[model samples]
Target: MDSYELAIRNTVEVVTEDELKELLKKPEKSVYTGYEPSGEIHLGHLVTINKLMDLREAGFKVKVLLADLHAFLNQKGDMEKVRELAEYNRRCFEAVGLKGKNVEFVLGTDVELNPEYQLNVLKLAQQITLNRATRSMDEVGRNMDAPHVSQMVYPIMQMVDIHTLGVDLALGGIDQRKIHMLAREYLPSIGAKTPVCMHTPILNGLNGKKMSSSEGNYISVADTEDNIRKKMKKAFCPPEIEENPVLQVLKYHVFPRLDSITLRRPEKFGGDREIISYGECETSYAKGEIHPADLKSACTEGLIEVLAPARDYLGL
Candidate 1:
């Protein structure tokens, strides 16, 4: 599939194919995807990583930023724990087959390598008003009262990463859309081309809300086959929820393969399964043509198949 098709399936909000193509035409242009290495990299993070892989396949230079400093700012705790978590996260990237010459992992603290970078971030922060900055507070799970001056400047630092790296495109999840938009808005004022922001849909928790670490609902990237299978089995996959979280995770990541296989094995899998597209799957599912149990099973197996290698890589 082409980049536009991939973007659509990935639920990114680029204005048009021409726009994306123009961005892609700049072969020298880099694409940046950052991860705050505060906790284990989860399935939610994988969706974004998968998108990064697609961008790389399309010939963009991909830079994976380990947001170690951001994590430290947001989730204040022991420094050693933070460092270990960042290291573990770097390994997760390796385990998931994301490591290569094209993808460079840079720690946030590595700004020291170029002393001027942090100053640039502070300058970017100065351009935006408090009103605009507060709009991104929901993303960090903080409010105006709770956020310190440094915390408030986090998005500025992130935007600086884009400018510092000189990326043509910025990749993130929907939750990060605001910060990205902020960067896009402020960058042009500073004479930098506004990086096109591409975001993947957020995978909800098993119960159909956004996934949360504190809620104990996330499935880590290093999860074993047994762990993945068990988690899928226990997931709240009831039919009543309009956006069945399990079904969404499957549609975005699993159902594509199922559609391909179902076309090939109509009789074995079921009747001529015309799930040729995700739209068809969503429609069929909404009409109850496909049972949730069958969908869940297929999702479970697909996730297991996809994550099995990572699990093995992690020696789980």
Candidate 2:
């Protein structure tokens, strides 16, 4: 695929298509995605990491923000704890093939503590109402039932990050659309350029529910081969194609990394077969040509192959 196609592949939406095409022709361009240091870097986080890799291949400088301060502000952990998580998360990102000269890792505290960054954040805070700020953070903030003053400052700082980093585009999951839209609407008033936002679909957990760390429904890079097998065996794979988590994984994570997937089965069950594309696989599965057991088995082995590098890097 060409640069433009590569940049926008698998994305749910880009704020403006014309702006992206114009930006693509520039001699220099940059894109960024921020992550609040979490306990586990699951497949949900990989959605954007994969996109960042695509952006790098598309000739854009990629910035990955390990938002230590953002995590602290969002009540994820204490400063020291979150900073430790930031370092670990950086290694996880690198282990998953996100390292290169063109990709720079920026810690939130590195640039966010500057006086100028603080001033821009406060300036934007003045224009954004409390209701708007609260709503913008609905999907991201922790303990929103009774929020702290720090939670109100979270989204404003995120907006300033786009300006302070000087990136041409912002990439995130669809959960971040509200915050990105707020940046597009308010950044121009402060004399900073409005950012072009790209959002990817939020993948469901193996059980076809919202991915949550508390529930242990998702796969982490650190999971062992045995753990992967056990989880995939119990994963919810219904007959329907739409909203099927197994198919979603094959579409978003597996096929993107592999040329094709082969379904391995015994001689009685139509033996083994090879599928070359996600579309063809989906069509065949939907037509009942492939059984659910074979589908999950293929997904289990494919995910293991895809994550082998990570497993080796992390010594898991």
Candidate 3:
């Protein structure tokens, strides 16, 4: 694929195609995505990490914000704890192939504590209403029923992050669409450049349920190969194509890394076959030409192969 297609493929939306195209024409530009520091970096994180890698290949400088302050302000933990998690998060991103010169890892407090950054944040906070801020955090804020004042400040800081980072594109999962749109609407009022936003689809866990750490349904880079295989065996693999967690894994994770997937099966069960593309695999599976057992087997092995670098990098 060409640069433009590579940058936008698998993305649910780009705020403006023209704007992104224009940025692509530039010799140099930057893109960034922020994540609250998590103790474990799972496949849910990899989806966007993959996109950042693609952006790097597409010739954009990639900035990954380990949103430590946002994590603490959103009540993830104490500042000290979140700051430590940020370091681990940076290592995780590097292990997953975001290493090298084009990618930058930025800590929230490093810039956030600066008087200028704090002033910009407070300036944006003045116009953003409490209702707007609360609504923007619908998918991300913890403890919404009786949210603390910090929760309301989270989205506003997020808007300011795009400005402070000075990125040409802001990439995130669709969950952040509201917050990005908030920036588009309000940033220019503060004399900050409105950011172009790219959003990726959210993938479900192996159980075809929401990916939650508590449930342990998602695969983390720290998972051993044997553990991954076991989880894939128990994964929800309904025959139908849509929302099949195994199929989603193949589409979002495996195929992107591998040119094609080899489905291994006994000769009695149609033997081994190489599926050349995600579309072809899905079409065959939807027609009942392939069995769920075989599909799961392929996915189990494919994910193992695709995630091997990260596994090895982390020495797990």
Candidate 4:
């Protein structure tokens, strides 16, 4: 694929593909995404990380903002706790192949604490109404019924993050679309450059539901081979192609990393098969040529292979 195609691959949408094309022509350009420092890094986070890697491959400098302060402000935890989570999240990101010459990791506190950064944030706060800010965090804010003051400030900080990082593009999952749109709309009001935005689809879990820690339906890099097999055995893989979580893993997580996936089964079960493309896999499954059991097994094997490097790197 070409640079534009690679940049936009597996993405749900780009705010303005034309603007992204124009920005790509510049010799020097950068892109970034912010993370809220969760306790565990799973496939949910990998979607954006994979896109960031693509942007890096396309020669755009990539910045990962470990938003420790934002995590704290959003009431994830106290300052120290969120900061520690940030460090672990950084290590996990590197283990998953984000480390390289073109990638730079920035802490939210490092630049966010700067007087100038704070001043810009305050100015933005004045212009952004509570209704707009609250709307922007609909997909991200912790508690919405009666939100804390800090939750209201989170989106503005995000807008400032784009300006402070000086990235030409901002990348994230579709959940962040509202926030990115807010940045595009309001950043110029604060005399900051608006960022072209890219977003990837939010993959559902093995149960065809939201990937949440409480559900334990998602796979993590730290999972052992045996653990993966166990989870795969119980994964919800319906016959249909549209909402099949196993196929989603194949399409979004597996195919993008590996060239192809080979499903090994006995001749009695149609013998072994090599799927060269996600389209072929989906088509085969949809046609009933591929059984759901076989589909989940292949996804399990592919996931283990893809996450192996991280397992070794972390010595887990």
TM-scores, all models, native as reference: 0.87, 0.98, 0.98, 0.98
Runs off by more than 4 Å, candidate 3: none
- The digit string of per-residue lDDT tens for model 1 on 109-221 reads 77623768866776777778877777775665354566677677778778888887778888888778889888877877667777888777778887667788887786887
Cα lDDT tens digits, model 3, 1-316, are 9999999988999999999999999999999999999989989999999999999999999999999999999999999999999998888899889999898999998888888878877888988889889999998889898899999889988888998888989999999999999999999988999899999999898888899998899999888989998999999999877789999889888888898888898899899999989999999999998999899998888889988898788777
The 10-residue segment of model 3 with minimum total lDDT is 112-121
Residue 149, model 1: lDDT of 71
Worst 10 residues of 2 by lDDT: 307-316
The whole-model C-alpha lDDT of candidate 3 against the native structure comes to 0.91
| Model 3 deviation from native, Cα RMSD in Å | 0.9
Report per-prediction Cα RMSD to one decimal.
3.2, 0.9, 0.9, 0.9
TM-score of candidate 2 against the unseen true structure:
0.98
The list of candidate 4 runs beyond 4 A from truth reads: none
Candidate 1 vs candidate 2, lDDT winner: 2
Candidate 1 — which residues are off by over 4 angstroms? 15-18, 143-145, 255-280
lDDT of 2 by residue, 1-316 (tens): 8999989988999999899999999989999999999988988998899899988988899999999999999999899999999999998998888997899999999999999999999999889999999999899888899989999999999999999999999999998999999999999988899999999999999999998987799999888899999999989999999889999889888888888889998999899999989999999999999999999999989989989999888877
Best of the two (1, 3) by lDDT: 3
Note the Cα lDDT for every prediction shown. 0.73, 0.93, 0.91, 0.91
Question: Best candidate, lDDT-wise?
Answer: 2
